[model samples]
Target: MTASRSSTRSPSVKVAEVSPSAASCLNVLILPLAIFNWYGGTWIRNELEVVVVVVVVVVVVVVVVVVVVVIIIVVMMIITIIIKNHNYAFIINRVPLYSA
Candidate 1:
C-alpha cells in the first residue's frame, strides 16, 4: 500500500502592521522604560546616597548646637565667679570709720 501526500500548503498569516504615528508613540513610551531599566540600580543607589548625606548633615548640626550650648554655659559660669571675687575684694578693702 502506497501512502498519499497532501499537495495543499498552509497560507502564511501576517501580523498587525503599525502606522507611523503609532510607531512614534511607541518610541516615545518605550524610551523612558528602556532608560529606567538600564539605570534602575543607579537610581536606587543615588537615593540611598542622598539619605546618608542628610543623616550626616543632621548629626553634624546637632553636634555643633551642643558644642555652642556648652560653650555658653562655661562662659556664664566664669563671669559669675569673676563678679563674686570682685565684690569680695571691694568689701575687704573698705576702711573702718572711727567716731570723731
Candidate 2:
C-alpha cells in the first residue's frame, strides 16, 4: 500500500500567494454582503436582527413541543384508567355517589 503525502503551507506563505490586488478584489466581493447593506444599516442592527429571529424561533418551537407532550400525557392517562377499570358505568356512579 502507498501512502499519500500532504504538504502544509505556512499562513504567511499562503497569504503572500494571494496577490494584494486579488485579495482586495476578494474583499470587495465579500465586504458588501458582510457589511449589511440590506437596508443600509450598522453591524449592531444586523447582529440584533439575527439574535431576535433565532430567539423567537426557539421559543415558538419549545412552546409547541411542550403543548404536544402535555396532550399526549393526558390522552395516555385517560386510556390507562379506562383499561384498568374496564367499567365506565362504575366510574360514573362512583363520582356522583361519593364525595371523597
What overall lDDT, based on C-alpha atoms, would model 2 receive against the true structure? 0.69
Per-candidate TM equals 0.43, 0.41
Task: Tell me the TM-score of model 1.
Answer: 0.43
lDDT of 2 by residue, 1-100 (tens): 1233246554566443878997687566545456665657655456456556556766998999999999999999999998877967777776776565
How would you encode candidate 1's per-residue C-alpha lDDT over 1-100 as one tens digit per residue? 1333245444574656989997787567555545776876344355455456556766998999999999999999999999877767666668656656
**Which candidate number has the best TM-score?**
1
Cα-based lDDT at residue 87, candidate 2? 64
Q: What is the overall TM-score of model 2 with all chains considered together?
A: 0.41
For model 1, the superposed segments whose C-alpha errors exceed 4 Å read 1-45, 88-100
Task: List the RMSD of every prediction in angstroms.
Answer: 21.0, 15.9
Give the Cα error of residue 28 in candidate 2, in Å.
25
